[model samples]
Target: MNLFRAASLVSFLTLLSRITGLVREQMVAAMFGASAVTDAFNVAFRLPNLLRRLFAEGAFSQAFIPLFAATRARDGDAATRDLLDAVASVLVAVLLAVSILGVVFAPVLLWLMASGLQAEDQALWMTRVMFPYILLMSLVALAAGVLNTWKKFVVPAATPVLLNLSMIACAALLAPWFRRHGIEPIYAMAVGVMIGGVLQLAVQLPALWRLGMVPRLHLTPGGLRRSWHHPGVRHVLRQMAPAILGVSVAQISLLINTQLASHVGPGAVSWLTYADRLMEFPTALLGVALGVVLLPQLSAARAKNELGQYSQLLDWGLRLVLLFSLPCAVALLLFGEPLVAVLYHYGAFRPVDVAETVVSLQGYGVGLLGLVAIKVLAPGFYAQQNLRTPVKIAVAVLVLTQLLNIYTVPRFGQAGLALSIGIAALCNAGLLLTGLLRGGLYQPQPGWGLLVLRIVIAALLLAGALYWMQHHWSWLTLPKGQRVAIVSGCLAASVGLYFAALALLGLPWWRMLRRAAL
Candidate 1:
């Protein structure tokens, strides 16, 4: 398999999802603006989103994929298929119970997450309405694991576009209708979340069926009990134990940050969320794309006892993160205000909101490389079936993050929350890389020093150009059409200059498309 090709395919598909996601965010910002209601919505959505990450895509996938790949390698397709059924059965039963509890305790969860929410009733209602989203998304995650193991990356990568589109439609069509009917427009977004969740899972079924790998879930009580006792299920649960803690540490940081942001001000949660939307462009395009493509292949390599190939995979992923993410980090730091203004400043989205979001965007940029690096680095331990090491690193980082937050949050506000997370991510990534090297699990390839020098040089050039454009343009004062046009042109030029500089420096950037074969 061509790792570059697979990763590119996932990246391209993810680009579509992120683009539509930005559009969704733009609509939300235009209609809702940065207010207590928007904060309520953001906080409410985080409930299911948190659990989805903690259980589904985070610990579950981290545990399941490596084992799933190894099972296929050692026991063949028939055994793997049976393993899938057992896992799916157990996952479904748990999801059903969790969703019910979330709905029943929506108020308690919302208060715990964001006690400062002004629109508590709206948030509670929306939380109940959207909590089941975790059930659907968890199933989608299961399907994604199965499809990725089969090297079917497109559907899994593309399904998120459906979610984005659903929200766009709701914000466009349903929001106004709700206002006319004397209902809060924000509730439309909750309905969109559910619709999007259903569509996302619905789309995955066909892809799973095409591979003849659709899991036959056991829905009955007896069947669920039997599936829970399955050996493969037990092994996955064991793997998920430390994996869950690692993911939980990160989520706990987010929860604490959200609680902090809520108390800071009304718009803090929404501001951070809008900035997060912009940040996702680089993260999803590079970090997530590479992580998804690398994990299965890394596990396969480990299964065959190919230590060299495993090290090479990690090296390739890290080099790509540095090469691409540095330029993105530069853009975010130097060009964030213009980007935020151009993308989000419309209708109810005031100039002040643009300014607020830019701060968070730049704060996140401070660790874009590390944030992306962790996506690749953590998987090294996960693929080695060693989840505890990353968990320990994560727990320490969690403490460090809160300690930094004590000083930064008081001074920087929501941006301080963003900064703390960014610094902690850098610490986390550094420790993970060190762990990998100390264990001899990963050996750095030659030319890393030269690669870093080239990336730094090119990033500086990009930063200089972007800084000039940012100062020259009146992004906040310009008319909408002019702002969009100039920002688009400047972005194009910046990208061109970054690549041109790399080429002039003898970096061979195009060779990325030819590297990382599995």
Candidate 2:
């Protein structure tokens, strides 16, 4: 499949997963509210999620995919199968060790991540209950990387839907019974997470079997060790170490937010979590979709020393990201409160919670553009096996984020945490783009500058129009029916205004769409 088509397929599936995830989160907020249980659950979920990214998604996949792709290119299917089995064997063993350690030391881990919480025991309980998820998910991630190499984006992207579905089912059907039996609903959610991970891994097995890529169980360390000596594997590892650090740097900003939120009043973590969920909707659907689809293509092109193709893919990816991301960012900034209120204002999630969460959501919205750009740009380095550059930049941004947090959190509370991360994302994006240019892997074509200028202008126009509508009209403040109408109207108007601006500025939306469609 072509880059655009691949990205579209990933994006569509991702959108479905994200929407379902939003529903699952809404259920959690309604049932748990922004209290100790919610905070504990949030921290618990984040801990495993952090590791999943660190080992599986961030470092492992970065290392695995390029070499896997290269092996496919040079050798035949058997070579690829052997490499996969070797990697899978090592992956399962390593993750099992890690999961066991996590189960044994859940309290210490929770204490470190959320030190400010007074309810340390509560936190530890949730962590212990949820930590097993990391093991299941890491395996899922390994399977996902294998699938992505086979150009099977659907199953991997769709796997997240199982997670959301599991959580939603548990919350809707099982939570009440658990509560009646004097059990905490959070435990039920924890169980749901473990089940979700199993389902996620299971869903991919059929696809692997179909491709004749099913990994065989092998306990021998030599097979995996051979990967270290292979040139492609060495190159991937070299790229992954820095990419891991780079991704970790970005994650530190989030870690700071989580820590700072813990220090704030009750419900702070939930509020931040809710805001993040909303922001992630667009980022996951657009940014992640592009990143996943672009990396293998870019990696293969770079392996063949095809700089022109790599550069073109980067260009196309950036344009497509901007095309969708810029408008979504604008919409979030404009209607953040209304969106938050609509999705999560029912049951235990009171109006006050909505108000607080929306503040953080809006702060996140302000940095949405930078966040999306960082997602689209960082893959370029990883594709070229140049992970260290992004890592250094990420560490710098991490320090900056913490410094900002130290200064801002005392003054602005949880919202300040969001603001600090947003600023850090902007800095991170600038550094990534600068690194790309300095490395001579990415440079603007003649129309590139003009295209960006037009996008900015269109965004500005849409923002102005939304601002006026928000201030001059009371539509957003209306009841449910009218509120939906008003939000929908604002969305339509903003979209129309942006497209009009694009056309007026001589941007080729139709041509881009046609190309993407083809």
Leading candidate by lDDT: 1
lDDT digits (tens) for residues 186-249 of candidate 1: 9999999999999999999888888788899898989988899999999999999999999999
Off by over 4 Å in 2: 220-239, 472-477, 513-518
> After superposition on all CA atoms, how large is the RMSD of candidate 2?
2.3
RMSD of each: 0.9, 2.3
* TM per prediction: 0.99, 0.94
Model 2 agreement with the true structure over 236-319: per-residue lDDT tens digits: 556667777777776666676787788897789889899999999888878898888878777788888989877777777778
Q: Provide the overall lDDT of each model, using Cα atoms, as 2-decimal numbers.
A: 0.93, 0.80
Candidate 1 positional error at 132, Å: 0.4
Clashes of 1: 0
Which residue pairs collide in model 2, if any?
34-267
